[model samples]
Target: MVNILEFIIRSKALYTTWIYYKPNRLLFDVGEGISAALGNKIYSIEKLFITHSHVDHIAGLWGFINTRNNAMGSREKDLEIYYPKGSKNIEDYLNFIKKMNKYLRFKLYIKEVEHGDIIPLKNNRCLKIFKTRHTPGEKSIGFQIIEKRKRLKPEYRNFSGKEIKEIILENGKDEVLEEYEKKIITISGDSLPISPDIIEDSDTLVHECTFIKESDRKLRNHTSLDEIKKLLTYISPKRVILYHISSRYNRLINKAEKELTESFKNIEFHIVHPEEISII
Candidate 1:
């Protein structure tokens, strides 16, 4: 059987944790209890990407750090974390945590990222980070994994590897240029209607739908069903997973599913709940 590519640890509106891997594993948004759910294993997490500094989104950092410290001698590599630059009180919070856990034995490398930055992953693939409109306290961001492609030039399609090399050596030049094609999986963590540019042509869009219906209430930092529909129309992703539903909407999952399915028949729609996992 083929290994699953993605899975969710928790999918509630207030908290979430997603795991993605093929060659390298990653934990996204380490909410509460995430370390316990992972069974104290520290080697599986090669990198952690934070979408924002919300308490619900980062409550598991302490647990994760403690777990890594406990497994310090056994771990083969250091843990790397990436988050938005200059967002919230993250620095102060992390400093406090570090001071409290002063005896911990492992290294935690934290890096701040900004929009349009590309983080290299294994196998020549890269994750592109982009900014999203959300609470000012936490600069929200989205991610897209891109793969670089190389193919023979149209004029040299029939040339063998050896021949191509010989031609380059003889001519002292080459006709190859890098090309990029991406299988983008975007996550809009706890945001209002995201900008179209943030999720354009994504293969999978994991978006929050806190409210299933339109509300006249002054817009807060959450998305509604109508806004999600408009996002779908604009991005047209292959799969759209709606998550982060409010606790009050627990009974409305089926209704939301029915309405979304009927309205967007061409797209694969999934209403994910806490503890539910999805492999993309």
Candidate 2:
């Protein structure tokens, strides 16, 4: 299953944060340098989920869209860019891009999503949007890739496949099955510490740990390592990848990671170093 598979690619992050989930061919953000860093790999991106319209998080939008339009060997797949509803920044940016890139070869979809909105993906999967406390009144959001499935309800748990088939023939599949959702990936786009409930049971969480020390955080809307420590107490994802670190902490990240690795023994921890490409 694609959910059980893992393939880390040479992707970029940092002041500009974006995570490419290879299995889904989805890009989280389109920060500057993303097109250059991902190079030809950018062509594979079918969907982009923008958490917010901050310049660093979306500066590369034009480059990506234009590249796909003019670059050789580009696929004609429709590219969907999802952002929080009422994001004036994104709204204006898209309007400008649409006028500038008028003779595009493929479809460029710009969608505005609100909290609790679900965007469908391939193979019974979807991207679920939720609110995040980032810049006040900025309508920032987070995303989770979930797989929807139907499983046998408790009352039908004891039945064999043949028995279930016989029962389905008499009744219906809906009578025997119950819908459930499994979290595949949770992405905390540039935001303050997110609520644990939003990311609960996620297989992998890509969160922003912008500041290692609380004092270093000049902005209250960004996340800090201290909050992540507290978050770890309740939220236990299979893996955690931290990104969007401030460049000032570039030299200290290794030591900080060493200490964190020693403290958190169960969950895998990864940091996307400042101004460098990191894959997980």
Candidate 3:
């Protein structure tokens, strides 16, 4: 069976929580305010992938922990959190949460992830964490969830099912009988003009676009519409989700959406608002 993957774009700030099942279920990047509240009701999130330690990105970390604890005995597994190495005071953050929730029953396992590390999941799927250009002060990382597939080997491409089965039985388990394939979904945290290579040919690319006009090019640490336009030359993502818009541009969402759709006809661009959920 194929896995079920869903990305929920909750409130502002590069906050997106992803739920993927087929393997174990996991959530990524809990943002500030009501985003975590919405995530609490979705699933028993067992794993969390954090991009960075920014306040807007990690503010809901404590709330999520508290919500899991309040579930009584419903949580049957430990919650594991993956964050970039040398990013921030992770130890202190964990200690503070533990101190605040003294009566919590479940265990929270915090793991430090490095660039190019693969986090194994159930059903042979894995998440590959790659370094990003965002948040240079602290080590920031991007996530790519990879789904593994097996196809008949080139030599057996024209063979019948029975023949394939026969070969599988004749050959040992260690024999390579098929070709492997991977489908990657990459998400970029808040960054200024991330390289298109980071998200090249991704099934879906979720990126932050804080500014929509060319005059806003001077803004630091945020991507502008011009920057995203430049990326289109190198990246051909099937779906392009623009998120983390500043509250000041709330009224201009429709205008931005229309302009983007007119500019990029081959790709679908979606503007994510607070409490809005999008499945990719």
Candidate 4:
């Protein structure tokens, strides 16, 4: 069976964060310490998507670019980075990185994307961006991987398997199904509880659960475990991988994970501990 998601992720609130999605060679948020963790695998990444310019979310860019250019690996593989369109901080930081690496050996491309924008990928998949509420005056976004497919239309759902096969054999499959898009994965990059519609029916959701305890949150920016639970009441995802958790919740993490698993029996739950890398 094909793996739904193959990723190495590390996240700690206010510290550093990054996700290396192996299937498509996509890296999300090049936070500090990522280079030391990913090492040679950095050369395999084709694109890096930044949700925002917060230091914790982007501090690794400098090291990543420098390492890929100088480290013992192929230097000809091109690297493309996509960030929110209105993020001036990321634009400036990318400029600084380019300036510092004047003798770079590879092609470094940077593009600014916004909500409702689509970035095409290989294997009939694409990435879509949606606006998110992170910090006041800071423009943040979330990403989802959508796949184009054809599925049986609602009007054809009641047909028996044999009858459906006969219909398809006679009329062709296109006559029984309609073209649609399926959201296979989503990343909630350091934002408030993502809207339910944005994540509904996803195969996997990599959401930021920064505050395990609701009372610990002072601002409306970061998400809490309670919010995630509430969000689940509206939509169902096959897997919910929680990350970017605060270090102070080390003791509370186990208990929270147990409860989450118990309550959402159908959804697999994963917690990315602060001090270690989670391979999934």
Candidate 5:
């Protein structure tokens, strides 16, 4: 069985958004209060992926850097932060962080990436980047975790166990098996509407549902429940998690949850309410 500890917390639509994935020791979008929320768990994180330069998505960098530098723990581990290539806002903030927090104990590396960039991780896992529509001019993106696995080819599937062993011994295991990619998780960071191809086959998909009603969707960069339903029609994920929800719907959360539960009965749907954490 695969062991993964995924934690997500957001405070309404304008507050913060952060997701900590413990299995890989990675954090996605370090919004405000992340260090306080995660506490000592922050030490386990070795990498951070920033989906955009929005204040709500990156406000935690200030405290996170300081916490890691002064906290009681192993400070030798390198923390790599990746952001979109052309986000000037993120670049400026990172530079400001460098100046403010000089002479750090641990090594901090910041990289800029564009669409189609593949970031390799430990244990044959990788992060695939793709473009997203958040702000019209700002550069935003989404991420997908892919695990490379070896599987028996179709031609060898019908062979018996003994036959497979014999075939492997003669022709080598590489000849009978092929390596394929399995999408483990996908994160659509504060996107308006994402393509099905990005998260279609993923085991777990975390998408933003900023508005529950279409009339509440006044911003062009935010997503709505209407759009999410449309995406669900073409793609089926093992788990669908909703985050970055607006606080305006706080009073109607229970009703909306029950309604969505009945509508999407076939799949598991998780909602991260305002100022709350959801673990999957």
Candidate 6:
């Protein structure tokens, strides 16, 4: 059985948005209040994957960088950050951060990433990036965690235990087993409903639900609960976490969650209330 992921997430449209994936010490989008939310744990983050340069999504990055440099924690650890390639806004902001902290204590590494870039991680896992649609003129992307797995080949699956043992002993285990990729998680950084084709085989999906009511959204850049419902019909994941929500529907979250649970019986639903931090 797959283990449930542990995460700390907060998203309030045009205010702040961030997610801390505990298992990998990975922080996605360094929005405002991140330093306060994570406290000293901010030093534990080894890498950061940014989706875009929106102020609400990356406002606290300077605080984050400064805190780690002076905070009372592990100070020598190097920090690596990856942002969407060709994001001139992000580049300019990063340059400002460097100038502000001229006497930094630790090393800071930054990279510009584009679609199809694969960042290898420990435990046979990798982080893959893909493009996402957001505000016009703003470059954005999404992330997926994929794992390498081995399973019995199709031709050997129906064999009896004894037969399989004999075949393995004769031909070696590698001959009967095949390698495959399993998408562990998918995070849709602030965007309209992401494509179902990308999240089809993923176990967990962390998507933005900016407008609970489709009628409330005037711009086509964000997604709504109704659109998410339609998207879920195309791909079924074990869990769906809705974040980057607008504060207007704070009182209606429970009702929406209840409805989705009834509709997607086999999938777990988690909504990150915009007013508070959500730990799951």
Candidate 1 C-alpha error for residue 106, in Å: 3.3
Give one digit per residue, the lDDT tens place, for model 6 in 100-158. Answer: 99988889999999999999887899999999999999999999999999999999888
By summed lDDT, the worst window of 10 consecutive residues in model 4 runs over: 1-10
Preferred candidate (lDDT higher): 3 or 4: 4
Model 5 off-target regions past 4 Å? Answer: 1-4
Weakest 10 consecutive residues of candidate 2 by summed lDDT: 5-14
Model 2, residue 21: C-alpha shift (Å): 1.2
TM-score of 1: 0.81
The global C-alpha lDDT for each of the candidates, from Candidate 1 onward, is: 0.73, 0.83, 0.70, 0.93, 0.87, 0.94
Report the C-alpha lDDT of model 2 over 89-152, residue by residue, as the tens digit: 8999989998999898898887899999999899899989999988787888899899998889
User: Which ten residues in a row are the worst by lDDT in model 3?
Assistant: 14-23
Deviation of model 4 at 9, angstroms: 0.4
Better TM-score candidate (2, 6): 6
- Ordered list by lDDT, greatest first: 6, 4, 5, 2, 1, 3
| Of candidates 6 and 1, the better by lDDT | 6
| Cα RMSD, each candidate | 3.9, 3.1, 3.8, 1.9, 1.8, 1.7
Residue 63 lDDT, candidate 1, scale 0-100: 77
Model 2, residue pairs in steric clash: none
lDDT of candidate 5?
0.87
Off by over 4 Å in 1: 1-3, 15-23, 40-42, 71-76, 151-178, 216-218, 275-280
lDDT of 2 at 128: 91
Better candidate by lDDT, 2 or 6 = 6
Residue-wise C-alpha lDDT for candidate 5, range 115-171, written one tens digit per residue: 999999988999999999988888999999999999999998988999999988998
